[model samples]
Target chain A: MKSLIDICDLSREEIDSLLDTANDIIAHPEVYSEKCRGKKLATLFFEPSTRTRLSFEAAMYELGGNVLGFSEAQSSSASKGESVADTARVVSCYADIIAMRHPKEGAPLVASMHASVPIINAGDGGHNHPTQTLADLLTIKREKGGFDGLTLGFCGDLKFGRTVHSLIAAMSRYKDIRVVLISPQELKLPSYVKRDILQKNGIPYTQTTDFESVIDSLDILYMTRVQRERFFSEEEYLRLKDSYILTPEKLRRAKSDLCVMHPLPRVNEISTAIDNDPRACYFKQVLYGKYMRMALILMLLGVN
Target chain B: MNIDSIKDGIVIDHIQSGKCMEIYRLLDLEKLDCQIAIIKNALSQKMGRKDIIKIDAAIELDFDLLGYVAPGVTIDIIRGGVLVEKKTPELPEKIVGVICCKNPRCISTTEQELPQVFRLADRERRIYRCFYCESMSK
Candidate 1:
């Protein structure tokens, strides 16, 4: 059975195919209104995530399918000490496909091993979030027309940002892509990511603490929040919390067509005043995320 | 100090100096009832200093654990006190239950029943990563 536990699990061709399907759905939503008719999607979220759970539920509803399962561990058998494998086995009997979110890394992988149906990892702690990467890819494709030869600037909390790691891994497969990592010394990209994905792929990249210094050369500025939950020390989190804030003034030297993006639930990292900028595509990215989820569900269910 | 040669046993040679005890502990040599000898910091022309282990029985060994703990070590199978076959353990592609992932966020850390798994991520650098979280095996 096919499952998406990591972004690297999908080949470049598969990602392109998914993007094509998403674009088609956007162009003609009526044609795919009932693509998953009579199917049931089980959303097993062990952690609390309003946005991702809603996106999955909304995707299933729009596909003429029913959504079931718990929103948190307290509401499910997990609180009673049921293993993820057991939960997946039981849920597989009812749902045609499953979207899982857990606070523990690789929980989806364990579920995928036991579940009879396909498993989609909505988010797994600070680990792989393949669906989010898919959303980001679709947004980049729509904005820049393609990934080739585009310079991407990743700002803030690169060390623990699973989305940034997954996107960099996905984009490394394309041609002539460069990266500009902008963050404080404490939050720079991990060395393994730099060595394995960027350096191994021969993609030229530069690291800097000053966001404005490299903002002009970027085609896409991916701003990420400095999540306090990922830090061990409150003092350290407070020290690095306001390291990089994207304001309208910072974009003065940037290109006219530069795409500014943030995986939502922003925490003052992005100024509200910049929302009106024509290049700000974060909200559109959210909508595209739903469409991509719809496409993914159809693909996994073999309806597409 | 002289250790007697085994009659029908196995000889593990060329272990990196100072790593024999780790290999011994991980291999659970203390659980074995058969006679075993560990020669540590022995002079070697190839490795400058090396360790060797002699087992007085032909019991099966966990080659994966051996390969992971002491790569490039040689194993000799003896029959009638004569060497019958010489084997070299290579870095295993996957290791299960040999080492636990220390990453607290890893699923293996929370799921106690799950087998601790690791895969060789970089062969040249001799680096292994937890199969679940991809954190480097320290």
Candidate 2:
């Protein structure tokens, strides 16, 4: 009856349960492989996302579920001027659950109204990607050993980074978590985030333009690229593009146990040379994404 | 035109003039067989132009539905040609099953089964967020 719509829908206990399920699926793959056998996952990707769509497909396939639906609006019934709700209604007859990615703000939310199946928001126009936050949670729990009492630093485009916003919202529930925000003046965390999630909950957080000065204090470093598209001018983006790239040299200033993370397809933000360092968990983050998704598939299908 | 007052009916007052027809259409008032009278461009001090709708039949109002289309409007119930009760709907705390959050990627939008549930994050400001997506509008 529940869907992974936003990270907030899952409480700390629910998230912990999902994580436990993920761990169990990882440890006992055979037991959960046929969990959703004969069920189908309908992927309604209105926007192009090869990676996320693939992850969902791969997750469903590994769970013995058939995958259907379009990769883009151009290929689907969307070309026939069908509304998101109508598409979802028709698709529900064919699938047990739907994973949707759209460029519009709430297209998936609208579709949910008429759907007969659980709707998973794959991603929405810089709005939300709860599964990504789930993956990040798994990465943090695995890399840092636990969720509580950690100093986390989020650097780069905090303004439009749905990943960053979701992570902050999800982590605010944990104990003794300090957030050190690093971004240019224009691309900083929105006030609502600070007010609604941080201050309202009394989560300890500090903002700074100085990433280099605070690198050593952080236990987890989340790197997001400064999206040029979100900016109005090239000159402004150029000035802020390299403001906080994580290079091999920068890693020297960081603590030995610091884990570096990036939502990949990364540009010049995190240097390729730094991949050799044990602290770089961006690649490992991707693998953890699969495990977490596998865990989600099992949990949602009621097999776990 | 002068007309006799009804014994019981629901009166919608202070509707934005041109929007009354839209609200009527939104409520599908045409389907009703009741004698519904619509007053256009009525005099109002608060709103420069207002419309009024009086349905000359005993009709119960759905306050939750009223909140969606006419949150700013006030409604009065008349009994025996006397104003017996007045109901001014407050905006819903959480809007479910009506209207849409403008966020396309919001799960409520993409999935066919779930009703669009938006939390009225700011009532005075008329901001609603998807309960599933966190998509907001001012």
| Candidate of highest DockQ | 1
Q: Write the per-residue lDDT of candidate 2 for residues A1-304, one digit (tens) a residue.
A: 6677678878898899888877777788888788888989999998789999999998888888899988988999887777787888899899988999988766666667678888888887777788889889988988888989999999999998989999999999989999999998988899889988999889989999988899999999999988776566899889888877888878898999999998876989999999989999988888777778877766666664
Candidate 1 residue lDDT tens string, A244-269 = 99988998899999999988889999
> Alpha-carbon error at B134 in model 2, in Å?
4.4
DockQ of 1: 0.72
DockQ of each: 0.72, 0.30
What residue runs in model 2 are displaced by over 4 Å at the alpha carbon? Answer: A228-239, B1-89, B94-118, B123-126, B130-135
- Model 2 residue B18 lDDT score: 75
lDDT of 1 at A236: 96
Once fitted onto the true fold, the runs of candidate 1 whose alpha carbons sit more than 4 angstroms away are B16-35, B40-50, B58-60
TM-score of each: 0.95, 0.78
